[model samples]
Target: MTLLTYLVPVVALLAQVAALPATSSAIHPRAPLAGQFAGDIGACPPLPMRTTVPTSVKDLRPDDFKAVMAIGDSITAAFAAEGMKLNPVENILENRGISFTMGGDKGAVTVANMLKRFSPKIVGASTGDRIVSLCSGRLCGIGGYFPQDRFNAALSGAKVENLDRELNYLIKTVKEDKTINYQKDWKFMSILIGANDMCDVCDGTNLDGDTYERLIRAAFEKVRINLPNTVINVMTIFKVSEIWPLTKNELQCKIKRALGLKALCGCAFVDGDTASGVAKRKVMDDYAAIWNQRLLKVVTEYRGKYDNFAVILDPAGGNTPLTQFDPSFVSNIDCFHPSERAHKYMARNLWNNLFLDSTNKAQKWPKDLDNTIYCPTATDRIQVA
Candidate 1:
């Protein structure tokens, strides 16, 4: 059976699973404590109060951010992230509460939680379980189903083309929230898109380098025009082609493939080390490089162009090989999507990246996942310049 044909049943199964009532079997696993990474690391001792909050995006400190927002695909929605070792059906739910970028569930080591240590009043981090079926266009909520989605407008199965819709939703939602000062509050927005586009390269999606660049640049332009006092972290797309050989041997991954249910990135999961497979892998790698290059170019063009707007390129997953992590870093459900462990590691890396200039940010996964969270001092500002 073709991979596309297998995806048909998988979609139907996901819908059925979404309707099933919650049970003990469906309970998500608890995320690791943020403090476990180091000894009794509580919230940062309050930094000496700022003399006056900075008005420009380039000068704002981490604590100055008043809101957190995100846009991407399943990874940001955190599909199947919490129930990695649980029943496959149960793993289909969106675990937004612990997503690396915008999740706000207590005890979960997420960027939102990490930021809360600094700016306790910041709004927009997603919380609780979000029904995967309800995740769609602006119909989901003004700013996504509140508490469950908050300002995280990301949708599962989204591509670069869908970013405009997500950005519109985010803009409307933030404007609607009464607590936020839309024109004045410092906002931190994280974006990790293009993975879905890269996944469809071999699927005849026709998303070549130029097309990718145009679509992504258009999305950033919208952000620059609409969202003032915003600092955007434009993360580079992952080298997903490298994941196939590392995961092909896993039993659950094997069964999912046999049933044609492993459709997240069909281009990356091609079988065997034969000439055809090697050729396809190389093509995916080339496309990934092109996509990331275009993304960097888009960010570079936005630099220093506006005083209240800054876009920083975060090279977290861009260069890291899948082999750098243990097998547990990926979900056991479909052997795709990052597990909660991976999210914790990502939270730390992202937090540390905020303190350093873009040029000095670590390009590889930290050798020590534990104790990697960087504590900001009196002098640290969220780096965008």
Candidate 2:
């Protein structure tokens, strides 16, 4: 029988496991994620605020930066919308071509294949180029994900578990190719995966919350091994139920649940077993919560982990008024994939979150140490009003 065929029963079993909701499952509610913008941009637990870096590559004066490279699935591909020549390859790679390689699917990716494709020629590249990376670039996926910011290799369908193979690939590549050292030139890496793991299974569908945690942990271990000193930033997945109706799938059921529709009363997006029914809706919330908790553990474990390596979470930084955006401009065209507009928003948000004001209000790059101190209490909120 085919793997999916063989796993049908297994998926059912997993769903049963997560379906058992607690009599009083109290979701730990925290403060609304504080952003410089207006609206319900959720926030994660407070991280020790680091002084923002005034100058990012995007802030580079005319002569300062060139060439940027992105590696991953469709999202990255979409980010490369203007074609390879206009892609970040110019800012980060300085004209050197990037080797394109990846294994992608609508709902999942495998670590094994990802490892097979990680070659120095692509990621490690030659010595002259810089790396500007993003991954789990696309959305709607199943398994095999590794979260790290060593290079922009984040891809959709990349689960937290797949980090081991990805890191191993990087380690092997660097070892074999003496000229490419991520430690010396690793500029920035972005982590935007995990939504798929959670979103893959929908209501009354299969599930496995426990294995998912293990996978995330495994990926963390691998990340530490490969890109120890790079600046790592993690972006939280968004609540998609509000946009469910916009999706092509019959997500009305999921939307109803999210909106407290009849059968979904009191159902937190991540409630397991009982949640099995709305597998699609719960995946993003559950996977993120699981990944976040474990990620915190990994962060603690890797404290002072890598030289200059740090983790920052940007939850709810997505363009707000998503419902109000011009349908033509709002991507995620397949209801699953991000359109060019979405990718542009993601790239800009990521760029601003890690280096500039989180509000995305700073009109210009900070000029000096003095300018760095100008971070305001909050910038103009991102309200559609």
Instruction: Specify the highest-TM-score model's number.
Output: 1
**Please, what are the lDDT tens digits per residue for candidate 1 over residues 1-385?**
1222343465554444311121112011232122212321244565667788797877877788899999988788887787543344455567899898988888788888877887889999998765563323334322244446889988776777788878888999999999999788889999987666666677676578888999988887787778788889988887877777777777777776666555656677754466766676677788888888888888888888888899999886788787766667777656777888777777767776776676677676554444345566766778785
* Top lDDT model: 1
What lDDT does each candidate get?
0.72, 0.33
Q: Can you give the lDDT of residue 380 in candidate 1?
A: 73
Clashing pairs in 1: none
TM-score of each: 0.86, 0.46
Cα RMSD, each candidate: 7.3, 15.6
- Number of clashes recorded per candidate: 0, 51
Report the C-alpha lDDT of model 2 over 87-125, residue by residue, as the tens digit. Answer: 323311211111211212211121111221221122422
**How much does candidate 1 score in TM-score?**
0.86
User: Which 10 successive residues of model 1 have the least lDDT summed?
Assistant: 18-27
